[model samples]
Target: MRPICLPERVAARAFPPLAPIAFACSLALQLSPARAQNALSVEPDTTAGSVPLRVLDARVRLGGERVRLPGRENMGLAGLTELLNVGGEWWVGPGVYGAATGHRGGLFVPGVEGAWSHPFNDWLAVDTGVFAGGGGGAAAPVGGGLMLRPHVDLVFRFPGFYTGPTFSKVWFTSGQINSNQFGWMLNVDSSFRYRPADFHGTATDGSATGLGFDHVDATVTMARPRNSTSTAGTPMTQRIGLVGLRAERSVDGPFWAGIEAAGAGSGGVAGYAEVLGTAGLRFPVVGDRLSLGVRGAVGLGGGGAIDTGGGLLVKASAGMTLRLTDTLGIGAELGLVDAPDGHYKAETAAVSLNWALDVPQRDLSDWFNTRPGTPTRMEFGTGVERYRAARKDGRTEALEAVVLQVNRFVAPDVYLTGQAHSAFAGGAGAYSVGLFGIGAQMPVSQRVRLGAEALAGAAGGGGVDTQGGAVLQARAYADVALTDSLSLRVAAGKIKSVHGGLDAPVVDAALVFSFGVDHKH
Candidate 1:
């Protein structure tokens, strides 16, 4: 069997936690009121019946854990997460964890977690939560890639943030790894602001909300390993293909900062992935239609038999872009990848399509008067999905996962969406996927609506056969409104590999929360 490892740096954890937590917190603080207040509670206390959904809070945290490889090899993992305070002292968000020590190079996990914070006094607090996700690449034994972590932290509160030590357990339920470890965490507090889901289709004075990011890019990248070494002390010859997404905001004229994530989709290197924090600058070369730029990134990655010693990585690149429209562009770049703690090096090239969103720039002085721009319609929710017999080795068991989805309506009946899924059952742990596309829906009854969506993106790991890592799926779904802001959604679809033999039927159920923001563009 090929030595399992992970991919290069694009996004996710390390360094006692992921850096994006701090990065994301800073962005939120820029859009928050200047007054000092508790980060855990942004809204006044109210019963759940009075408000279904609203802006909760902004938080950032870091953690660490220890794990065991086969043959008694040991490794340490650093984890980081950024969360949205959703009221009731609860937080929900995404996080990344990667091997920070020992011999494991591409060991990483990216997944979602929900946490609850309780205050014991004005100066002390406690946090308890669980994380669910998947990943495993290099010689790591995260069988099926499913991982569960339950942790607690005791923290000391300051004016705007809190720090403390944490204790937790790491369990790969269907795999060959389980351990208990100690770590640390940090949480930042910020202002709260959000309109209810009932306002999803109404107009509001354009204000900045969410991360307040100004640009996004969808990219396809190719990396050619150059004189790379495997864990077994042999030369690596596989050229890897990747799919990625990046979200960015301008910090100054011609300069920007962003976060990105990518996964292997080709080259038979499934289970390889990366998450990175990036900074770059762009200068106009041909007026506003063309530009040239350079960027640098740092984060954790490993897996796919590639030696990423301790899963710490950094990259530098230079490139150019051509504007295709006011909101879209095409770009290309050349870069070099290096692992400071491992034996991995590569020459990389990529092509990307970019979008400029209409939102407030990264201005820190305009928080008190800002009102977030509203969309015509929007839906955010979580659900569960299952894939029937989708494994590459011809297994018959069904693969089940937890999914998160966001849908935005561009027209009255047409919408665009993005989704992420992490497998938790069917022995397919550590398998994750990201997808984006468009859909259309229409109301068919007083309380019901029907819709269909076509999506394409990248998937890998957990022994699933997503050839070259690219996949296409289409789903038809029905929605029954439970409240103005809440609904029940059920969908059925088929997912097919664009380059391999895995074809399967899929079904899912979700609790969707709908809201609208007014966009003044």
Candidate 2:
């Protein structure tokens, strides 16, 4: 998802209706000048000549509406430290963030962030940074975050070309009322972005908001090839290529707005479309040190060969970066995306602590290691399980059952497993059972893997018994990364049973094939 950015002028325009109410309250305060004076006396002095100090600033935001999550309320906190250079052009700071459901605070996350700034010749300067942290308020333990952003600007001194640095600064100088009166004050002078290849963070503003940078904008992404099937059970294979373009304007001040269009090709799915409008705002958090801001977009026109029945697509987010020392700091974000038919409705909150080392600009391969050709891997597995049937009266004796298994992974983290079982009894005829199972795997470590499964089959007399279970399996036997697409696993654990089985002791092993999304931490 992208952060939502509002233009200074637009933000200024949005203030009028709400300003009267606030101004009236401000006037009531005038009645107590003595109290106001006393308040000022106790307030921390933020003067240009004060000694540099760390200021702790945090925000708790709660937003709930009919949109997005339907009837759910979303809330989060941005805890940060703003390093002020009370007297210089360079500033830096870092902090952490966490968000959760409004009803329950049980699911909580903590993440880190950092930012830095150096003014060059007053009119031009460059800013660059990164972040890595995690925990979605909903799945705190498994959540993660990471981001990298570096940007430069050519400041135009004249109002004719560039807008002022902040909305507050611009409005104070021109004395012109605008829609988003406080819009500029809430921005950091940098772009909001993430690396898409790793799925470590959400898409960049261009991809999320359908906005562009400069007059010409381009984007491209490629994932390792694989194969899978749709929910409708259609077989599909994929060789990835994701690309797009758009038109953008470098607005004055810490803001920009544009329009964009992009397309993706993978498996049997292909689609393209144009975004309506997108905008962003960036400004320093405290002086030239820490930075924070928002960026967002809404769909406008163009529906392509693969339309998800588009009505509206929107993206919004808020982020902060802090500079800890020179090479390390923390960053965090709260983002959301909503598209037609719930195709793009995802609320994501993440934080990261990152350490970056300056590397000379080099070819793509210098940054990423890749094999000259595709690698082929194979795996074979088998396991035995026992199910002790419940004992009845004297007429029947307890039954002991055993199963044989086999599985294979056709792609990364995907598998197909098969099992056969036979039952032996002291008082009845020996009966047999068969099962075919399919599932997905997520590896957390060398000996731990998390997975969900669905299976269907019949027992003695062809009595049907279908089951589904979520497995948190651990390999008690071995530890090794077998291959890019294959993992050697030996696990034993209880699964959340979804079917009725007579106290089945699930002790079985088989080769497994897995596929689908990878949630990385």
Candidate 3:
């Protein structure tokens, strides 16, 4: 087998004071309101006549312990958040995010948001929301102000609808605001959804696979953010925004595929529209209580800061909901994140706990359609390899190898996996044995994981071995799940092998590309 080339550990240093300063002036918006206040409430409103319609409820949170940026003297927090809700003809919420892992006094901000929804009946609803807010940390010179925004949303259920307009503006405190800083956003989106009872031989509700008319959605958006630097002792910012669209289709139970396009620029209008595409699978495990999924995407675009161009993003996640009683339940999520560019990305594994209030018991069909419970599935892969002997006059050989892996829950904190490698070279067919192992997967975040494994396998006839030997390995794998199936994996491992009276030590590193399934139970 070819030796796995490990990636060098790139120290995650603190961000430069100037970088945070630049981001603050460019993207700083607002502090996220606490979740305790926003979580969905089950309290019945006697004044409203009936329980309000649960139109939408979604929350995303990202952060970890304090860490320093590269070549910077600042120590701050790193995290992101996005939340939204539409109920009883009113839509209210906020989308707040920031990277404050730098200066002693970091920057923080939250944008304003509001929306009005009008239900024309049980099937159609028209809604519009606006947001405006901005702030800088203790580093602000003028205490910074807010940016006003206005946008609308139209919803059509079952058959769905497409083609609507969205407009927004960033009104700054003064003209001194960078050119790249001030601009507008214009967007149009159209989507169609279909959920048929049955299609072909695949039942839309069972059998781990569903078939229906492919769903499609298209969106185009334009934005401009000032991007400039001080030249004559005056701060200058440039203005830029990319326009792009994405289309996707989800088969009821098993798989989905999507593609996206967008322009790039720190200021003004982007010159190139970057394109990304992905496809993957999903499956359920543990009697519909857990799901497993994986996915990968490739970027095709320009390079440099103007683009960083394109690369890859991948992730995998598994989740389960525990019912404590009829009306209350608890849930958990564990996953990974990985990206090629560390500056714009980093791999992470995360786990979260949530409590559900007054959740209704889902039927088999509804359970199959909803995607909230999924398991983490192990991935197996194979590739070619070449080995160079250590002694002089030693021959160089090319080999083909197959790798097998299985990731599943063996118990509460323990996970089991097995792998085997077979190779062929020269006139001899050498197989490096089968590896049976088990370990614990400790989640640190939505994109990072720490694991250890022990194995014993036999070598099929490669000179230095007899029968089978034992090996112990510890590995850290960082993964980023961009979608249900596509994910990027960066891992490092150290192993010690003992056989026939001799012990050999080995170290391996790999930047692996993975594509697989993500399913919800």
Best candidate (score: lDDT): 1
Off by over 4 Å in 1: 1-54, 68-72, 197-203, 231-234, 285-288, 359-376, 390-392, 517-521
lDDT of 2 by residue, 1-521 (tens): 66555444443433212222222222221222222233443553422122111222221111111111223433222112222232334443322222211221111111222334454654554332232222121211221112111222223233111222221111101111111112211222221111111122221111111011222333333322223222233432433333333334445567655543333322222212223345667588777457787867554211111222222446576877575633344656566644443222345454544222221112233333221211111223333333334322313223333334433333345544443333322221122333445556676785456664454332321111112111121122332344433444554433222233323434444433211111111
Each prediction's TM-score versus the true structure? 0.82, 0.21, 0.26
Model 3: per-residue Cα lDDT at residue 54: 17
Off by over 4 Å in 3: 1-93, 96-109, 114-130, 135-142, 150-168, 172-251, 254-282, 295-347, 354-521
lDDT of 3 at 219: 25
Ranking by TM-score: 1, 3, 2
lDDT (C-alpha, whole model) for all candidates? 0.71, 0.31, 0.31
| Per-candidate total of colliding backbone pairs | 45, 62, 70
RMSD of each: 7.6, 26.0, 23.0
lDDT of 3 by residue, 1-521 (tens): 66543211111222222222222211211101111112325652212111111123332222212332234332332222233343555544333313233322212233435667566776565555555444322222212223343444444433212212222232324211121111111111111111111111211111111111122222222222123222122332333332233334453346555443433222321122233444445465555444455544443222122222112223334444444433223443344333232222222222222212112213223321344322223333222222321111243333332333433332334644444333333222222333445666565676555556655432222332221233344455555444333344444554333333223333333222222111222
lDDT by residue (tens digit), candidate 1, 278-383: 8788999998889999998877776655677777778899999998765568999999998887888899999999866543222123222233334446677688
Which scores better on lDDT, 1 or 2?
Answer: 1
> What is the lDDT, from 0 to 100, of the residue 427 in candidate 1?
70
Clashes of 1: 45
Model 1's alpha-carbon lDDT is: 0.71
